[model samples]
Target chain A: AAGVIQSPRHLIKEKRETATLKCYPIPRHDTVYWYQQGPGQDPQFLISFYEKMQSDKGSIPDRFSAQQFSDYHSELNMSSLELGDSALYFCASSRMGPVNSPLHFGNGTRLTVT
Target chain B: SQQGEEDPQALSIQEGENATMNCSYKTSINNLQWYRQNSGRGLVHLILIRSNEREKHSGRLRVTLDTSKKSSSLLITASRAADTASYFCATDAHAGNMLTFGGGTRLMVKP
Candidate 1:
């Protein structure tokens, strides 16, 4: 089975720079969720989209924005990046109807701020 | 806000011993799920128990939910070094599909 795919397994950026992370969800999955996990910390919900429309928002920062494309893939963009933004960015996908369904996760992108 | 809170932030045990972790949440939820992450990798779904269900089992894993107390427990029987990882309990509340995760319990099984 095809799992969620995240690009740029590792990313390095400097302060005040911009970065874009992309996600390709599993086929037929209509919901995409983004999460950020800092070192030695639990994953934090960032934002989510259902069928290309933003459905829920979490602790995502103002400098960060995300959107799901017509093909069900999603992208998270961060600007004016800060050192605190360095973390493992994960993308998960699930079917929209059953909220209890399991979420398929990608390996995630490791963002490092220099 | 984070929902589930797990106990014993870290646990260490010998191989073949059983490992158990507990989780408590604040609000009512539609379901609770257990996930495992090795080091810095992505999370892998272990098992899920619905709100109305009391207990569920998969392979060597057992999950129990007590909606009354808003708590849940996960037990891994006959543990192995391979099971060494961080375990987290996540809850999806009646509010929406977004899952609120716990602080996670780090388990280290010795060989």
Candidate 2:
């Protein structure tokens, strides 16, 4: 089975720079979720999209924005990046109809802000 | 904010032993899920127990949920070295599809 795919498995950036991460959800899955995990910390919900629309927001910073395209792929754009932005960014996908469906996650993109 | 917190920050057990991890949450939830993550990797969903269900099982994994106490437990029977990883419990509130994750319990299964 095809799993969720995240682009730029590893990214390095400097302070005040910008970075864009992409996610390709599994086929037929309509919901996309983004999470950030700092070293030795639990994953934190950043944002989510359902059917190409922003559905929910969590602790995402103001400098970060995300959107789901018509094809069901999503992109997370971070601007004016700070060193604290360094973490593993994960993307998960699931079907929107039934509740309790397990989320399928991608390997994630490691962002290192220098 | 995180809604769940796992007890016993870390555990070390030999292979073939049964390992149990406990989680406590703060609010009402429609369902609770368990996930495992190998070092520096993505999370792998293990099992999910709905609010109405008390217990569930999948392969060598068993999950029990007590809605009244706002707590859940995950047990891995006959654990193997491959099971060494961090386990997290996530809660889905009635509000949305978003999940609030717990701090997680690190389990090291020795061969």
Candidate 3:
């Protein structure tokens, strides 16, 4: 089975720089979710999209934004990156149903902001 | 916010011994799920138990949910070193909603 795919297994940036992360969800999956995990911490929800529309929002920073394309692929754009933004960024996808379904996650992108 | 809180933040056990982790949460939920993650890796879904269900078994993994107590547990039978990882419980309180993850329990299985 195909799993969620995230680009740039690792990323490095200086403060005030911009970075964009991409995600390719599993085939036929209609919902995409983004999470940030600090070292030794559980994953924290950022934002989510359903059917290419903004569905729910979480603790995502104001400097970060995301959108799901027609192809079901999503992108997370971060501007003026800060050191606190350095963490493992994960993308998960699932088939939307009457009840929440399990999420398929990617290996994750390790972002290091210096 | 319905965040799951795991007990005994860390556990160490010998191989072949059973490992159990507990989680407590506030608020109502529709379902609860468990996940495992290796160091610096993506999360792997272990099992999910609906709020209405009491106990469920999947292979060597057993999950028990007590809605009345607002708690759940995951038990891995005959654990191996490969099972050494962080275990987290996540709660889905609503349909089509994101899960609230617990702090996670780090389990280390001795070879």
DockQ of 2: 0.71
lDDT of 3: 0.93
Tens-digit lDDT string for candidate 1 (A11-66): 99999999999999999999999999999888999999988999999999999999
lDDT of 1 by residue, B16-100 (tens): 9999999999998899999999998999999999899999999999999999999999999999999999999999874457888
Instruction: Assess each model's interface with DockQ, reporting 2 decimals per model.
Output: 0.72, 0.71, 0.68
- Writing each residue's lDDT as its tens digit, candidate 3 over B3-90 gives 8689879999999999999999998999999999999989999998988899999999999999999999999999999999999999
Q: Candidate 2: lDDT of B54?
A: 98
Lowest-scoring 10 consecutive residues by lDDT in candidate 1 chain B? B92-101
Pairs of residues clashing in candidate 2? none
> Can you rank all candidates by lDDT, best first?
2, 1, 3
Off by over 4 Å in 1: none
Question: What is the per-residue lDDT of model 2 for residues B29-67, given as tens digits with 9 covering 90 to 100?
Answer: 989999999999999999999999999999999999999
Assess candidate 2 and give its TM-score to the true structure: 0.98
State which candidate, 1 or 2, has the greater lDDT. Answer: 2
Candidate 3 CAPRI assessment class: medium
Quality of model 2 by C-alpha lDDT: 0.94
Over A15-60, each residue of candidate 3 has an lDDT whose tens digit, in order, gives 9999999999999999999999999888999999999998889899
TM-score-better candidate, 1 vs 2: 2
> Which CAPRI quality tier does the interface of model 1 achieve?
medium
